[model samples]
Target: MASTAASASPPPAGWASDPGVSAPLRHVRAIIADHLTHGPTDPTLAQRRAWRDALYDAIALPPDVVSTPVRDGAVRGLWQSSPGARHDHVLLYIHGGGYEIGSVRSWRVISAVLARRMGVRAFSVDYPLAPEAHFPAPVDNVVAAYRWLLAQGIGAHDIVFAGDSSGGGLTAAALLQLRMLGLPEPAGALLISPWLDLTNSGKSIDDPPGYDPFNPRAGLESFAHDYLAGHPATDPLASPLFGDLHGLPPLLIQVGGDEALLDDSVRFARRAGSEQVAVTMQVWPHMFHEFQAWAPDLPAASAAMDDAATFLDRALADAR
Candidate 1:
């Protein structure tokens, strides 16, 4: 969902590029194109995992953050924090990879960045991947992780949930699941380019208005299939866009105009807004998927992170 009201800010400056952003940062679209051409496209599980791991492993994390291993029943994750962190506040971060490949190690840099930016101790889940552990498994693991946080004495009001892409869908679904089972929801949620519609029901996905260098529609559809593993894609829990949006926590969603998943965010924002949920949606022009992954280097990414940090700060304050 994009900025639904006048309160939301617009995109960055020049080429919509912030000043001081290097040529490498500005050349991101080209870089992605080049990488895809040279990168392996093997759909084989082993090959796919290797490619993803290599790509994410190359992301450089700042040296000062600490990431400690932790577990909650079947869930495994990393507790990430920086000097700016509050030991009492917790963020449950779910990583994207269509519920298949991502892990806490792969998302360390982003987790660390959020920890510093939001001044909270963040936990990144290493939920079991798909083809091996499909629907319900990943979502359930997220629930388990949240319960673990509760058991640690972190109140629901002190914790926030967040994720990107499929993980974003998981965050929304998990919140819905919690509410269904009489569990308290978190303070709020932050979704980055969330893949909320598994049915590819979003119009923009088929008739995209801008160029998206990555994330082909068919490829994403395939990932959905793998994760569903014969389950119904239209199930509200699987494709949260079709689900009831009422009574969920505050939501802050950021999405790129150029991405195919644009409508997924847009529709979710509209639904949430209709449901009277507090939602601040920011639509960044001409940006790519999960652009925030390159934050502090790319102006757009940094700006998006700042937006998220501000939203979370306000939401947490309101919760308190």
Candidate 2:
């Protein structure tokens, strides 16, 4: 049976000492840390998009994976698939940039790799960003893409939802919305370093035991403000960490043990488990926020993707 227990205890004791953090991984971490420290404190939306894409897209995708642009209804994204991938199974991916930045092209480094690894097609949605479309817009876009998938004859049991950072939060909100609509639930979900708490109320935000090169508290506050657009931060759809998780599908939350948002996954797993949801939360020691994006070079990143592929395969097989 699948483990429902949440992983990783609080305070993340001595995560920086993990031997798995190789020299290349440390160099990558340093580069990102320097960029976060010295880069523009307040960047325009265009500049943010350019910088994020340039940085993330630098991580190349597997050569065998093919990518194609997709535009249908409210669903705008990239479809990535490897040779011999299953046509019956699909991975609905949401790219993360705090709901402000990130695009389908930028996230191919992640979703595409998972597609190749799982031998399945992955649809990475390019949802409307904050300041462009706030509140429920991104959530609605995800729901519409899901509906489009079903229209293509894919069963709910053959699909698995996955997202990183804010996209992860959006995935959670979308699941809640699906439940509310009385729609069939997908097989399961993978939340990658999910930023589920928009209020920045988690203790890890203020005091993290390990180094996290992501945005500071004020930056997160600004992003949340833009996305919320006067909506209450505590609103379930806006912040799933603050929402009722009952009846949601099984969840596998993979978070970096060293990321400041570690508590977001830890606390979310705790609450979901308390509500009888099957939750598997893995805290990767010495990894930073969304470290899975640095795969091939980072051993831990490849390992994380390996774990994700295993989970996705098992979930879909069990559903069958």
Q: Against the true structure, whose lDDT is highest?
A: 2
Model 1 clash count equals 4
- Per residue, candidate 2 scores C-alpha lDDT tens digits across 79-117 of 999999998999999988878878889888889898789
| Candidate 1 C-alpha lDDT tens digits along 27-116 | 664445544545543345666666566655766787878889986568699999888689888889999877766677876766678768
Among all windows of ten consecutive residues in candidate 1, which has the lowest summed lDDT? 1-10
State every prediction's TM-score relative to the real structure: 0.90, 0.91
Q: In candidate 1, which residue ranges exceed 4 Å CA deviation?
A: 1-25, 41-43
Residue 181, model 1: lDDT of: 83
RMSD in angstroms between candidate 1 and the native structure over all alpha carbons: 6.7
